[model samples]
Target: DTAALMKTPLKKGDTWYLVDSRWFKQWKKYVGFDSWDKYQMGDQNVYPGPVDNSGLLKGGDSQSLKEHLIDELDYILVPTEGWNKLVSWYGLLENQEPIARKVPNAIEKEMRKLFSIPDEKEIRLWNKYMSNTFEPLNKPDSTIQDAGLYQGQVLVIEQKNEDGTWPRGPSTNKLTLTLQ
Candidate 1:
């Protein structure tokens, strides 16, 4: 019955970007409808029930997360100072999309080079662990070897807010690091 309203028949590889309710109002004007009532009566099919998460999906159903992932750099972690300078250079905001590149095998060495950190000093990667805490990534790190990193991971250097409060360090500070 829904197919009867579509201008074109749904194809085998059809996909759609679902927008939230906040942006849904813009569709009426963009679709050239004079009023909400007219839009409601248009060729597009409407479901009366609430949207279900499992109902609409973009990619192949059989593919695993690893299969869906590309072998490219997914995230970058930079020190706050260095990040500020880099943002100034690009004239952009704090968050930006990454340009695609192959994931490096030697993440420790690569991160040191990117961070301009010394060999003796260990560079720690941090991520949000809970509501207000962040924890350092625990991986094999050394001057001579890789940090055993993989793609799709986002890590950052710890930072303190402007109110003289630490955002994500207390939890990690309490954790004891033991060497085997």
Candidate 2:
């Protein structure tokens, strides 16, 4: 079904995940339809089911507080500062798709320009950090090593830690330096 959908030309009823207003506008232009109308149709919800969550669980009247404590824990543990922190760290969260596609490349380009390195020093640094940090956490028997330099100014090093263990301390860890 997915393959068929992809192969067939998009029709009026076909669903799409628009990245932003710009992409929506572009799709509207291509499809010869009013963007507002398309948005209106997309906004409409026609689910044929009870909307409320109340009284949905079995034995709802007799449910004990101790038994359901974990279920309500998420509500109590809500990080009020999380949204602000995420926005501060990652910028506006609404336009995530475009930012996800564009930001790393932009950052890499800027870093390369700032460092004035012909080779991809930034990518190497990223690879090193991932090897040291994530590979240990996720996989076994994976070792990263220095892959050599891209440009004269940059050095490409592979992770050599066999156990995939991350080094500790402030100045000694390659991952820490790369992140900084």
Candidate 3:
């Protein structure tokens, strides 16, 4: 039913069902309906967006996040300061959607190989459990999915600021790596 209704206008109560506002905005402009705000119904709450951890979703988000993430960058590799410290840069992959059902402690051993980390510093990614040997990935794991990383995305190999922020050495700095 919803699939068949995609091309047609839909309403939830008195408000218009907004599948996507950006698409609608662009759709209107491409069709020369941008100024047709009067034709556009419903409040901002009808916008569509990604679902958060609670299994709940916030609708009608335009600037904060996006949907149909196939053509976007899933994550950014940001270098930390001092030694090697990687904070979280979360963006989901393009073609390969993440397995959202998985628990928070998702594991990805290969993510370690993606980083250009020094040999001595690699252990920093693991917890200090020398004897028991029950250590897990110290790398930023949430950026990784058990299903595998997004295509063409790789790790950052730079030093971040002492406060655990990405280093912006110049007016513009972009570090991209190809996942091996």
Error of 2 at 89 (Å): 32
Which candidate, 1 or 2, would have the higher TM-score against the true structure?
A: 1
- Tens-digit lDDT string for candidate 3 (63-94): 33333333113321111220011012222213
Question: TM-score of model 3 relative to the true fold?
Answer: 0.18
Candidate 1 lDDT, 1-52, residue by residue in tens: 1112223322222332221232233223334434435555434454222211
- Candidate 3, which segments miss by more than 4 Å at Cα? 1-109, 114-139, 146-149, 160-167, 170-180
Q: What is the lDDT of residue 178 in candidate 1?
A: 38
lDDT score, candidate 1: 0.36
Candidate 2 weakest lDDT stretch, 10 residues: 136-145
Q: Which ranges in model 1 have alpha carbons more than 4 Å from their true place? A: 1-103, 129-131, 140-152, 158-180
Worst 10 residues of 3 by lDDT: 78-87
Q: List the residue pairs that clash in candidate 3.
A: 47-60, 48-60, 74-91, 80-159, 80-160, 81-160, 125-138
**lDDT tens per residue, model 2, 1-180:** 222332443232233321223332333344335534454333324211211112222344322221222212211111223323323433432313211111112333444556676553313233233333411112111211112212223323233233644243222333334454
Candidate number with greatest TM-score: 1
